[model samples]
Structure formats: structure tokens, C-alpha cells
Target: MSRDSLSPRSRLVHDALRDAGIPGEIVTLPDAAATAALAAAALGVEVGAIANSLVFWSDGGPLLVMTSGAHRVDTAALAERLGRTSIVRASAEQVREATGQVIGGVAPTGHPAPLPTVVDEALAEFAEIWAAGGTPHTVFPLTFDDLVRLTDGQVAAVD
Candidate 1:
């Protein structure tokens, strides 16, 4: 889709990518890609190639975990790894306030402020990864290294 056709949130993500010198175009899908499974189906790629942006509440406040679709975040392990007291899932309102986007459409970038991010190392297995474009029907492609660089995310075994 053209830049002009992007939603406000998508526009923010688009701009963020551009400013970061990341290469990708936001692609609007014919159907909603609210879940990694749906996004993978729409893109005809393996589900593991979808980077799921998840927000959580940690001792340091909001934390973003960009995980691979093939696995689930191990909160306990993550807490231990981060040396945090606890890491719990953020409520919808908390997510929106932190990321400026809804749960299903949360992107790795374009947040109101920079959030401490941890990206799943497993995602590096895929050459091209797809992430939400600030909306359920939109997405963008990037390399694993580009994603880590764009978010300044620490590479970890989050799942």
C-alpha cells in the first residue's frame, strides 16, 4: 500500500523504519492479520517467520518482547534472565499507553517512547521476518538483524 493509505499508527511505524534506515514497505493484507498464524497464512510463509510483538510489565516498567510465532514466551525464564522480580503480561490499556497501538497490532518500533526490548534469537533463523504494521491488516518485512538493530533489542532465548 501507498504511504498515504497507511493508518496513523502504521505511518508512525513507517516513518520509524525510514528514519532508522531499515529497508521494508508496509504491505496491507486482504484480511486481518491479528495473530501470527493469520499473518503467516496471508503471507504464505512459515509461522515461525512472524515476529510477534508482545508487551509485558516488568520491574523496569513496560518491556517489549519480539518473539517468534513458533513459540511462547517463558515469563519465568525471562524474569530470571533479566534479573527482574517479576514480568507479567500488560493489560490492554497499559499496552496501548506504552506502545500507542492495540495488543494484536503492536509493532516493534514507533512506540511513544523507547521500551526495553528483547528479541527471540530463534527468529534469526529466518532471513525475512514479518511484523505488524500498527494495524491488523498491515505488515512489513525486515531481516532479523535489521529488526534487532531497529529496536535496539537484546537478542535472547525468550521462548
Candidate 2:
């Protein structure tokens, strides 16, 4: 499948990538890529090459963690990194409300506001990475720099 032929969220992701001056084309897979392992297997890449857009609720507000698939975001460590007391996983509704996309399909971009974003340092190992394009079956290729610029994310230790 192609990125052009997809749902509204996927299309929006595609357009956003172009608007952000990033070279990304939508890739549709037969499998439901709801997890980093699944996406890595489907794309035939390292698990770290999958940029998992994770949503969390912090004392400050909604936080977006663009983490590498190979590692889990240590929330307590992340909270310390952000100088916060706590960080909790966002509810499904909170995730949708904050990112304007479903839980399994949230992209790094296309949120209503500029979410406080943290990008995993592990993702830098890949020249190109794939992130969900606002849908479970959809993804778009991106570079670490482009991902940072597009999401206005800060590079940090997520795990």
C-alpha cells in the first residue's frame, strides 16, 4: 500500500511531512503495526528504527515521548529528566484529545498544541526511521533531525 491511498489521518501526516520539508512517503502494511516489534518486523529494520509516539500525563500537562522502539521510556527517569515529580501514562481518551489521533496511530506531529516532546537518543542510530502516520497500518519514513524539527522535540535519554 501507499501513503497517498489512506485515511484522513494518514493523509494529514503525509501532507504535514511535506509541509515540514521532510521527505516521507506513507507505507501501508498488511499487518497491524500497533507495536514497535511488529513495525520493525514488517519494515525489516532494527527495532530502534521505529519511533514510537508515546503519550504521557505529567504534572505540567500532556507530554509526548518520541521513543525508540527498542527501549521502554522509564517514566520516573524521564520525570527526573524533565524536572518533574511524576509522569503517568495517558488514558486512551487523553491520548486522543492531546494528539488528535487514536492511541495506536498517534504521530509525532498534527497535535492541537505543541506538546512537550522528548526524542529518544537511541533513535539517532538510524539514518532513517519509521513512525506511525496517524494510523496503525500507516507509517512514514523520517530522519532523526527531521523528526526533531517536525515535532519540535528535544533529544533526551528516554530509557
Candidate 3:
């Protein structure tokens, strides 16, 4: 679909993408793909190619982890990697407050403000990566390099 027709939230994400010089555009799925497995299935790609946008409450504020679908973030390991005392999942309210979007549709960008983001090194294995587009049913595809450039993320082994 055209950028002009994107949902309001998605339009924000689209604008962010374009402003960042990313060429990929958002696409809406017929069904909601709230989970990485579901999104990978809908997009007919390996589950590992799905970049899950996970929000965490850590270091006294919000953290965004763009991790691979095939694994979970090891909080203990991540804490060590980030030099933080603890890392915990953010509440739905906190997620919305930090990202300006709900849990199921939190994109890596388009937040109310900038966030500390981590791009999984494992995601660099994929030729392309897919992430949510500000809503459950919308998504956009971009390369691993695009993701790093878009978020100014720290590349690390998050899982």
C-alpha cells in the first residue's frame, strides 16, 4: 500500500523510515501477527528472520531490543552485557508510554522519544528482517544494516 494510506501510527513509522533513508514501505497483513512466529508464518520467512521489538524496564528507563524470533533474551546475560543490575519486561502501560504504541505493535522506531535500542547480532544472519509497523497487522521489511542505521542501535548478542 501507499504511504499516504497507512494507518496513523503506521504513517509515523513510515515517516521515520523515510527520514532515516530507508526504502522499505509498510505492508498490512490480513491477520494480526502479534508474535514473531505468526509474523514469520504470514510473511513466509524463517522465524529467525522476524525481528521482535521487545521493550524492557532497565537502567531506570526503557530499553528496546530488536531480537530474533528464534530465541528469547537472556536477561542475566543481557544485564552483564549492558552493565545493568536488572532487566525486566515493561508493563503494557509503560510500553505505551515509552513507545507511543502497544506491546503487540511496537516498532523499533516511531516512538514518542528516542530510546536505547539493541540490535541482535543474530539478526545480521538474515538477508532481510521484518519488524512491526506500529500496529499488530502492519509490518515492514528491511535489511539488517538498515535496522542498525535506522535505530542507531548497538549491535550485540542479546540472546
Candidate 4:
């Protein structure tokens, strides 16, 4: 679907991407890609090629971890590496408050404010990766470098 036809949140992501100098167009999936596996199946790509936007509550702040779909985040390991005492999953309300988007559609960017972001180093293995576009049914392709730049993120091992 065209950008004009995108949902409000998806359109916000589209505009944010454009402003960020990303040339990739947002693609609306026929079904909701609420999880990495679903998105991968719909896009016909390896699940690892999907960037999962995971929001965590750490030290009273929100941290966005753009992890690979292949594995779950090792919270303790990640916390230790980041010098954080804890990094627990955010609740649905917290996710929405921090990202201004729902859990399944939280993009790396386009939140109400810029969040401290971490890009999964494992994702660099893929030449191209897809990320949620502010909604579960929308997504866009981007390079690993594009993710780093778009989110102004620090690269780290998420699992």
C-alpha cells in the first residue's frame, strides 16, 4: 500500500524514515507480522534477517534493543554488559508510552522521543534486514548500517 494509505502510526514511521534519509519504502503485509517468525515467513526470508524491536525497563528508563529474530535477549548478560542491574521486559503500557507504538509494531525510530537504542551485532551478518514500520502489518527493508544510523544506536550483542 501507498504511504498515504498507511495507518497513522505506519505513516509516522514512513515520514520518520524519509526524514532519516532512508530510501526503503514501507511494505504492508497481507497479514500482521506480529512476531519475527511471522514476518520472516511473510517476507520469505530467514528469521534472523528480521529486526525485533524489544523495549526493556532499565533503571527507570526505557531501552530499545533492536535484536535479531533468531534468539531471545539474555537479559542478565545484556544488563551486565551495559552495567545495568536489571533489564526486564516492559509492560504493554510502558512499551506504548516509550515507543508511542504497540508492542508488535514498535520500530527502531518514530517514538515520541529519541530513546537510547542498542543494535544487535548479530544482525550485521545479513546484507539486508527488515523492521516493523510502527505497526504489525507494515515493515521496511534496511541495511545494518542503516539501522545504526537511523537509531543513532550503539552496537552490542543482545543475546
Structure candidate 3, residue pairs in collision: none
Tens-digit lDDT track of model 1 for 1-159? 677989999999999999999879999998999999999999999999999999999995999999999989999999999888999999999999999999899999999999999999999999999999998888999999999999999999997
Error of 4 at 68 (Å): 0.5
- Segments in model 2 whose C-alpha atoms lie over 4 Å from true places: 1-4
Question: 2-97, model 4: which lDDT tens digit per residue?
Answer: 888989998888989999899898999999999999999999999999999999999999999999999799999999999998999999999999
lDDT of each: 0.94, 0.89, 0.94, 0.94
Candidate 3 lDDT over 8-110, as tens digits, reads 8999999999999998889999999999999999999999999999999997999999999998999889989989999999999999999999988999999
How well does candidate 2 match the true structure in TM-score terms? 0.94
Regions of candidate 4 where Cα sits further than 4 Å from its true position = none
lDDT minimum window of 10 residues, candidate 2? 1-10
Q: How many Å off is the CA of 120 in candidate 2?
A: 0.4
TM per candidate comes to 0.98, 0.94, 0.98, 0.98
Clash pairs, model 1 backbone: none
Residues forming the 10-long window of minimal summed lDDT in candidate 1: 1-10
Better of 3 and 4 by lDDT: 4
